[model samples]
Target: MLWAGSKGGLEVRTSAGGATVLRGRFPYAVPTVLKDGRERLREVFEARAFAASVAAGGDIHLLVHHDFDRPLASRGAGSLEISDGDDALTFEATIAPEMRGVSYVADFLGTLSAGLVGGISPGFRVAEGGALVKRDSEGLLRVVRSAELIEISAVTKPAYPQAQIEARNWTPCTAAEDRTLVHALNRWRL
Candidate 1:
Protein backbone atom coordinates (compact mmCIF):
# COMPACT_ATOMS: atom_id res chain seq x y z
CA MET A 1 0.00 0.00 0.00
CA LEU A 2 1.18 3.50 -0.84
CA TRP A 3 1.21 6.10 1.89
CA ALA A 4 -0.76 9.27 1.07
CA GLY A 5 -2.96 12.04 2.55
CA SER A 6 -2.08 15.29 4.14
CA LYS A 7 -3.34 18.81 4.73
CA GLY A 8 -5.32 20.66 2.03
CA GLY A 9 -8.43 20.64 -0.13
CA LEU A 10 -9.95 17.99 2.13
CA GLU A 11 -13.45 18.26 3.51
CA VAL A 12 -14.31 16.08 6.52
CA ARG A 13 -17.60 15.96 8.41
CA THR A 14 -18.84 13.96 11.38
CA SER A 15 -22.22 12.36 11.08
CA ALA A 16 -24.57 10.34 13.31
CA GLY A 17 -22.76 7.78 15.52
CA GLY A 18 -19.57 9.71 15.14
CA ALA A 19 -18.98 8.47 11.65
CA THR A 20 -16.41 10.53 9.81
CA VAL A 21 -16.89 11.24 6.12
CA LEU A 22 -14.60 12.58 3.42
CA ARG A 23 -14.09 12.63 -0.32
CA GLY A 24 -10.77 12.76 -2.16
CA ARG A 25 -8.91 11.82 -5.33
CA PHE A 26 -6.30 9.03 -5.52
CA PRO A 27 -3.96 7.80 -8.23
CA TYR A 28 -5.20 5.08 -10.57
CA ALA A 29 -1.75 3.70 -11.30
CA VAL A 30 -1.18 0.53 -9.27
CA PRO A 31 1.98 -0.30 -7.32
CA THR A 32 3.20 -3.65 -6.09
CA VAL A 33 5.25 -4.73 -3.10
CA LEU A 34 7.30 -7.58 -4.49
CA LYS A 35 8.19 -10.60 -2.40
CA ASP A 36 11.87 -9.74 -2.70
CA GLY A 37 10.97 -6.50 -0.89
CA ARG A 38 11.11 -4.11 -3.84
CA GLU A 39 8.38 -1.66 -4.76
CA ARG A 40 7.48 -0.41 -8.23
CA LEU A 41 4.59 1.35 -9.92
CA ARG A 42 2.56 -0.51 -12.57
CA GLU A 43 1.57 1.10 -15.83
CA VAL A 44 -1.83 -0.55 -16.15
CA PHE A 45 -4.27 2.21 -15.29
CA GLU A 46 -7.35 1.27 -13.28
CA ALA A 47 -9.85 3.79 -14.49
CA ARG A 48 -13.42 2.66 -15.13
CA ALA A 49 -13.39 -1.09 -15.63
CA PHE A 50 -11.88 -1.59 -12.19
CA ALA A 51 -14.33 0.83 -10.65
CA ALA A 52 -17.19 -0.93 -12.39
CA SER A 53 -16.07 -4.26 -10.98
CA VAL A 54 -15.98 -2.97 -7.42
CA ALA A 55 -19.24 -1.07 -7.89
CA ALA A 56 -20.81 -4.24 -9.18
CA GLY A 57 -19.85 -6.08 -6.02
CA GLY A 58 -20.99 -3.00 -4.10
CA ASP A 59 -18.89 -4.09 -1.12
CA ILE A 60 -16.04 -1.67 -1.08
CA HIS A 61 -14.37 -1.31 2.32
CA LEU A 62 -12.65 1.41 4.31
CA LEU A 63 -9.27 0.17 5.41
CA VAL A 64 -5.73 1.25 6.23
CA HIS A 65 -2.74 0.19 4.14
CA HIS A 66 -5.00 -2.04 2.08
CA ASP A 67 -5.07 -4.42 5.02
CA PHE A 68 -8.38 -6.26 4.87
CA ASP A 69 -8.07 -7.35 8.49
CA ARG A 70 -7.67 -3.75 9.52
CA PRO A 71 -10.92 -2.69 7.96
CA LEU A 72 -12.46 0.14 9.93
CA ALA A 73 -15.78 -0.37 8.25
CA SER A 74 -17.34 -1.53 5.01
CA ARG A 75 -18.77 0.49 2.15
CA GLY A 76 -21.98 -1.44 2.47
CA ALA A 77 -22.79 0.19 5.81
CA GLY A 78 -22.05 3.48 4.13
CA SER A 79 -20.88 4.34 0.62
CA LEU A 80 -17.48 3.63 -0.95
CA GLU A 81 -17.59 3.97 -4.67
CA ILE A 82 -15.02 5.09 -7.24
CA SER A 83 -15.60 7.18 -10.33
CA ASP A 84 -13.15 7.90 -13.13
CA GLY A 85 -13.46 11.59 -13.75
CA ASP A 86 -11.08 13.05 -16.35
CA ASP A 87 -8.37 10.46 -15.63
CA ALA A 88 -8.73 11.09 -11.91
CA LEU A 89 -10.20 8.53 -9.54
CA THR A 90 -12.32 10.10 -6.84
CA PHE A 91 -13.88 8.25 -3.88
CA GLU A 92 -16.22 9.09 -1.03
CA ALA A 93 -16.31 7.03 2.16
CA THR A 94 -18.63 7.17 5.18
CA ILE A 95 -17.23 5.40 8.25
CA ALA A 96 -19.91 4.39 10.76
CA PRO A 97 -20.09 2.89 14.29
CA GLU A 98 -18.84 -0.32 12.81
CA MET A 99 -15.54 1.51 13.00
CA ARG A 100 -16.06 2.54 16.60
CA GLY A 101 -12.72 1.13 17.69
CA VAL A 102 -10.72 2.86 15.00
CA SER A 103 -10.43 6.25 16.70
CA TYR A 104 -7.38 7.25 14.69
CA VAL A 105 -9.54 7.18 11.60
CA ALA A 106 -11.59 9.88 13.27
CA ASP A 107 -8.44 11.79 14.05
CA PHE A 108 -7.29 11.30 10.47
CA LEU A 109 -10.57 12.79 9.30
CA GLY A 110 -10.30 15.61 11.80
CA THR A 111 -6.80 16.42 10.64
CA LEU A 112 -7.95 16.02 7.06
CA SER A 113 -10.89 18.38 7.62
CA ALA A 114 -8.51 20.86 9.14
CA GLY A 115 -6.51 20.52 5.91
CA LEU A 116 -3.98 18.31 7.66
CA VAL A 117 -4.06 15.33 5.32
CA GLY A 118 -3.51 16.16 1.65
CA GLY A 119 -3.20 12.83 -0.17
CA ILE A 120 -5.15 9.68 -1.11
CA SER A 121 -3.78 6.15 -1.66
CA PRO A 122 -5.01 3.11 -3.50
CA GLY A 123 -5.58 -0.16 -1.57
CA PHE A 124 -5.57 -2.94 -4.15
CA ARG A 125 -4.84 -6.64 -4.69
CA VAL A 126 -2.90 -8.50 -7.37
CA ALA A 127 -2.34 -12.11 -8.33
CA GLU A 128 0.41 -13.88 -6.44
CA GLY A 129 2.48 -14.23 -9.59
CA GLY A 130 1.81 -13.14 -13.12
CA ALA A 131 3.46 -11.71 -16.20
CA LEU A 132 3.88 -8.25 -14.74
CA VAL A 133 5.64 -5.16 -15.97
CA LYS A 134 8.36 -3.27 -14.15
CA ARG A 135 7.83 0.46 -13.86
CA ASP A 136 10.40 3.04 -12.97
CA SER A 137 10.05 5.92 -10.56
CA GLU A 138 8.65 7.93 -13.45
CA GLY A 139 5.83 5.36 -13.91
CA LEU A 140 7.27 4.00 -17.13
CA LEU A 141 6.19 0.34 -17.35
CA ARG A 142 7.89 -2.31 -19.44
CA VAL A 143 6.21 -5.72 -19.85
CA VAL A 144 2.68 -6.94 -18.87
CA ARG A 145 0.78 -7.08 -15.57
CA SER A 146 -2.61 -6.81 -13.87
CA ALA A 147 -3.95 -5.79 -10.45
CA GLU A 148 -7.25 -6.71 -8.87
CA LEU A 149 -9.74 -4.13 -7.60
CA ILE A 150 -10.16 -3.37 -3.96
CA GLU A 151 -11.00 -0.46 -1.64
CA ILE A 152 -9.08 2.77 -1.47
CA SER A 153 -8.24 3.97 2.04
CA ALA A 154 -7.11 7.10 3.82
CA VAL A 155 -3.69 6.87 5.40
CA THR A 156 -1.85 9.11 7.84
CA LYS A 157 1.57 8.27 6.41
CA PRO A 158 2.11 7.65 2.71
CA ALA A 159 5.01 5.57 1.41
CA TYR A 160 5.31 7.74 -1.70
CA PRO A 161 5.88 11.47 -1.35
CA GLN A 162 4.21 12.11 -4.68
CA ALA A 163 1.31 9.91 -3.58
CA GLN A 164 0.48 11.88 -0.41
CA ILE A 165 1.95 14.09 2.24
CA GLU A 166 2.17 13.30 5.94
CA ALA A 167 1.17 15.87 8.51
CA ARG A 168 3.98 16.96 10.79
CA ASN A 169 1.83 17.44 13.89
CA TRP A 170 -0.11 14.22 13.53
CA THR A 171 1.87 11.54 15.36
CA PRO A 172 -0.60 8.69 15.57
CA CYS A 173 1.04 6.08 13.37
CA THR A 174 1.10 2.46 14.63
CA ALA A 175 -2.03 2.91 16.73
CA ALA A 176 -3.82 4.07 13.60
CA GLU A 177 -3.17 0.72 11.91
CA ASP A 178 -3.89 -1.67 14.77
CA ARG A 179 -7.05 -3.21 13.38
CA THR A 180 -7.13 -5.95 15.99
CA LEU A 181 -7.21 -3.62 18.96
CA VAL A 182 -10.66 -3.07 20.39
CA HIS A 183 -10.88 0.67 20.89
CA ALA A 184 -13.57 1.19 23.53
CA LEU A 185 -12.45 4.74 24.26
CA ASN A 186 -13.60 7.28 21.72
CA ARG A 187 -10.80 9.79 21.21
CA TRP A 188 -12.38 11.87 18.47
CA ARG A 189 -15.39 13.87 19.79
CA LEU A 190 -16.09 15.44 16.43
Candidate 2:
Protein backbone atom coordinates (compact mmCIF):
# COMPACT_ATOMS: atom_id res chain seq x y z
CA MET A 1 0.00 0.00 0.00
CA LEU A 2 1.20 3.47 -0.92
CA TRP A 3 -0.18 6.78 0.33
CA ALA A 4 0.78 9.49 -2.12
CA GLY A 5 0.10 13.09 -1.27
CA SER A 6 -1.02 15.22 -4.16
CA LYS A 7 0.65 18.48 -5.21
CA GLY A 8 -1.63 21.37 -4.19
CA GLY A 9 -4.96 20.19 -5.56
CA LEU A 10 -7.39 19.74 -2.70
CA GLU A 11 -10.22 22.19 -2.02
CA VAL A 12 -12.96 22.33 0.62
CA ARG A 13 -15.79 24.73 0.05
CA THR A 14 -19.38 25.39 1.06
CA SER A 15 -22.08 26.09 -1.51
CA ALA A 16 -24.88 28.59 -1.19
CA GLY A 17 -27.35 25.89 -0.20
CA GLY A 18 -25.10 24.91 2.74
CA ALA A 19 -23.72 21.80 1.06
CA THR A 20 -20.05 21.28 1.67
CA VAL A 21 -18.03 19.99 -1.26
CA LEU A 22 -14.57 18.57 -1.25
CA ARG A 23 -12.79 18.55 -4.61
CA GLY A 24 -9.30 17.33 -5.38
CA ARG A 25 -7.01 16.49 -8.26
CA PHE A 26 -4.18 14.13 -7.53
CA PRO A 27 -1.52 14.84 -10.11
CA TYR A 28 0.32 12.12 -11.99
CA ALA A 29 4.01 12.19 -12.88
CA VAL A 30 4.94 13.98 -9.67
CA PRO A 31 7.99 12.34 -8.16
CA THR A 32 7.92 11.53 -4.49
CA VAL A 33 9.98 9.39 -2.19
CA LEU A 34 8.54 6.27 -0.60
CA LYS A 35 10.05 4.01 2.00
CA ASP A 36 9.99 0.27 1.38
CA GLY A 37 11.36 -1.36 4.50
CA ARG A 38 15.05 -0.46 4.43
CA GLU A 39 15.04 1.03 0.96
CA ARG A 40 13.88 4.37 -0.40
CA LEU A 41 12.37 4.59 -3.85
CA ARG A 42 11.56 7.53 -6.09
CA GLU A 43 8.09 6.89 -7.44
CA VAL A 44 6.17 8.57 -10.23
CA PHE A 45 2.66 7.81 -11.34
CA GLU A 46 2.13 7.70 -15.07
CA ALA A 47 -0.91 9.27 -16.70
CA ARG A 48 -4.11 7.34 -16.16
CA ALA A 49 -2.49 4.94 -13.73
CA PHE A 50 -5.76 4.41 -11.89
CA ALA A 51 -7.96 4.22 -14.97
CA ALA A 52 -9.02 0.64 -14.51
CA SER A 53 -9.90 1.17 -10.89
CA VAL A 54 -12.06 4.20 -11.58
CA ALA A 55 -13.62 2.50 -14.58
CA ALA A 56 -14.48 -0.51 -12.46
CA GLY A 57 -16.51 1.79 -10.19
CA GLY A 58 -15.13 0.51 -6.94
CA ASP A 59 -16.08 2.18 -3.70
CA ILE A 60 -13.40 4.59 -2.51
CA HIS A 61 -13.72 6.40 0.76
CA LEU A 62 -12.76 9.86 1.92
CA LEU A 63 -11.01 9.47 5.23
CA VAL A 64 -9.08 11.53 7.73
CA HIS A 65 -5.40 10.79 8.29
CA HIS A 66 -5.81 7.51 6.41
CA ASP A 67 -7.88 6.12 9.24
CA PHE A 68 -10.50 3.62 8.12
CA ASP A 69 -12.43 4.21 11.30
CA ARG A 70 -12.77 7.90 10.41
CA PRO A 71 -14.37 7.78 7.03
CA LEU A 72 -16.08 11.00 5.93
CA ALA A 73 -17.54 10.03 2.59
CA SER A 74 -17.86 6.97 0.42
CA ARG A 75 -18.81 6.01 -3.11
CA GLY A 76 -21.18 3.35 -1.88
CA ALA A 77 -23.29 5.99 -0.19
CA GLY A 78 -23.35 8.24 -3.31
CA SER A 79 -21.42 10.98 -1.58
CA LEU A 80 -18.18 10.42 -3.47
CA GLU A 81 -17.26 10.61 -7.12
CA ILE A 82 -13.93 9.63 -8.70
CA SER A 83 -12.65 10.07 -12.22
CA ASP A 84 -9.35 9.62 -13.99
CA GLY A 85 -8.12 12.47 -16.14
CA ASP A 86 -5.16 12.96 -18.46
CA ASP A 87 -2.87 14.45 -15.86
CA ALA A 88 -4.57 13.60 -12.62
CA LEU A 89 -7.20 11.63 -10.75
CA THR A 90 -10.09 13.91 -9.81
CA PHE A 91 -12.63 13.48 -7.06
CA GLU A 92 -15.64 15.38 -5.75
CA ALA A 93 -17.41 14.54 -2.52
CA THR A 94 -20.49 16.16 -1.07
CA ILE A 95 -20.46 16.15 2.70
CA ALA A 96 -23.57 16.88 4.67
CA PRO A 97 -23.77 17.98 8.28
CA GLU A 98 -24.78 14.52 9.40
CA MET A 99 -24.25 11.41 7.35
CA ARG A 100 -25.14 7.83 8.15
CA GLY A 101 -25.97 8.89 11.71
CA VAL A 102 -22.51 10.39 12.20
CA SER A 103 -22.41 13.86 13.67
CA TYR A 104 -18.73 14.70 13.31
CA VAL A 105 -18.97 16.13 9.83
CA ALA A 106 -19.28 19.71 11.08
CA ASP A 107 -16.38 19.28 13.45
CA PHE A 108 -14.24 17.90 10.70
CA LEU A 109 -15.19 20.77 8.44
CA GLY A 110 -14.38 23.23 11.17
CA THR A 111 -10.96 21.74 11.67
CA LEU A 112 -10.34 21.73 7.94
CA SER A 113 -11.46 25.32 7.56
CA ALA A 114 -9.30 26.38 10.46
CA GLY A 115 -6.24 25.21 8.48
CA LEU A 116 -5.44 22.38 10.83
CA VAL A 117 -5.77 19.64 8.22
CA GLY A 118 -2.93 19.08 5.77
CA GLY A 119 -3.82 17.85 2.30
CA ILE A 120 -5.10 15.03 0.16
CA SER A 121 -3.38 11.68 0.08
CA PRO A 122 -4.39 8.84 -2.18
CA GLY A 123 -4.05 5.27 -0.94
CA PHE A 124 -3.32 2.83 -3.71
CA ARG A 125 -1.66 -0.46 -4.62
CA VAL A 126 0.36 -0.96 -7.73
CA ALA A 127 -0.88 -3.75 -9.94
CA GLU A 128 1.30 -6.64 -11.00
CA GLY A 129 3.67 -5.68 -13.79
CA GLY A 130 2.42 -2.15 -13.47
CA ALA A 131 5.71 -0.57 -12.64
CA LEU A 132 9.12 -0.22 -14.27
CA VAL A 133 12.26 0.28 -12.30
CA LYS A 134 15.49 1.95 -13.31
CA ARG A 135 18.62 3.01 -11.57
CA ASP A 136 20.38 6.19 -12.50
CA SER A 137 22.19 9.04 -10.84
CA GLU A 138 18.92 9.62 -8.96
CA GLY A 139 19.09 6.18 -7.40
CA LEU A 140 16.15 3.78 -7.73
CA LEU A 141 13.18 5.12 -9.70
CA ARG A 142 9.80 3.45 -10.03
CA VAL A 143 7.41 4.47 -12.80
CA VAL A 144 3.92 3.34 -11.96
CA ARG A 145 1.78 2.61 -15.02
CA SER A 146 -1.20 1.04 -13.31
CA ALA A 147 -2.62 0.88 -9.83
CA GLU A 148 -5.75 0.35 -7.78
CA LEU A 149 -7.04 3.44 -6.01
CA ILE A 150 -8.41 2.48 -2.62
CA GLU A 151 -9.11 5.73 -0.80
CA ILE A 152 -8.27 9.39 -0.47
CA SER A 153 -7.62 10.98 2.88
CA ALA A 154 -6.89 14.24 4.57
CA VAL A 155 -3.72 13.95 6.57
CA THR A 156 -1.68 16.06 8.96
CA LYS A 157 1.64 15.46 7.27
CA PRO A 158 1.89 14.88 3.54
CA ALA A 159 4.74 13.39 1.57
CA TYR A 160 4.45 16.10 -1.08
CA PRO A 161 5.33 19.41 0.40
CA GLN A 162 3.21 21.30 -2.11
CA ALA A 163 -0.01 19.59 -1.08
CA GLN A 164 -2.60 22.00 0.28
CA ILE A 165 -6.20 22.41 1.48
CA GLU A 166 -8.40 25.48 1.52
CA ALA A 167 -11.93 26.48 2.42
CA ARG A 168 -14.16 28.93 0.50
CA ASN A 169 -17.72 29.75 -0.38
CA TRP A 170 -19.03 28.75 -3.81
CA THR A 171 -22.11 29.56 -5.83
CA PRO A 172 -23.14 27.86 -9.03
CA CYS A 173 -23.91 29.93 -12.12
CA THR A 174 -26.62 28.95 -14.57
CA ALA A 175 -25.77 28.33 -18.22
CA ALA A 176 -27.69 31.42 -19.34
CA GLU A 177 -25.81 33.54 -16.85
CA ASP A 178 -22.55 32.07 -18.08
CA ARG A 179 -23.37 33.00 -21.68
CA THR A 180 -24.44 36.46 -20.65
CA LEU A 181 -21.23 37.04 -18.76
CA VAL A 182 -19.20 35.86 -21.73
CA HIS A 183 -21.16 38.09 -24.07
CA ALA A 184 -20.66 41.10 -21.83
CA LEU A 185 -16.95 40.49 -21.72
CA ASN A 186 -16.82 40.16 -25.50
CA ARG A 187 -18.76 43.38 -26.05
CA TRP A 188 -16.50 45.20 -23.63
CA ARG A 189 -13.50 44.00 -25.65
CA LEU A 190 -15.11 45.40 -28.88
Candidate with the greatest TM-score versus the true structure: 2
TM-score of each: 0.52, 0.76
Q: Any runs in candidate 1 off by more than 4 Å, and if so which?
A: 1-10, 14-19, 28-46, 67-70, 97-102, 110-116, 127-146, 159-190
lDDT of 2 by residue, 1-190 (tens): 5566664567877778777788988888777655433455566778999999899997889997666778888999999999998888889998875552464555567678777765788876554576778876666777878867778987665665642212100122234543231321221100
Pairs of colliding residues, candidate 2: none
lDDT of 2 at 50: 92
Worst 10 residues of 2 by lDDT: 181-190
TM-score of 2: 0.76
Off by over 4 Å in 2: 35-40, 100-104, 162-190
Q: How good is model 1 by TM-score?
A: 0.52
Candidates' C-alpha lDDT: 0.46, 0.68
lDDT, model 2:
0.68
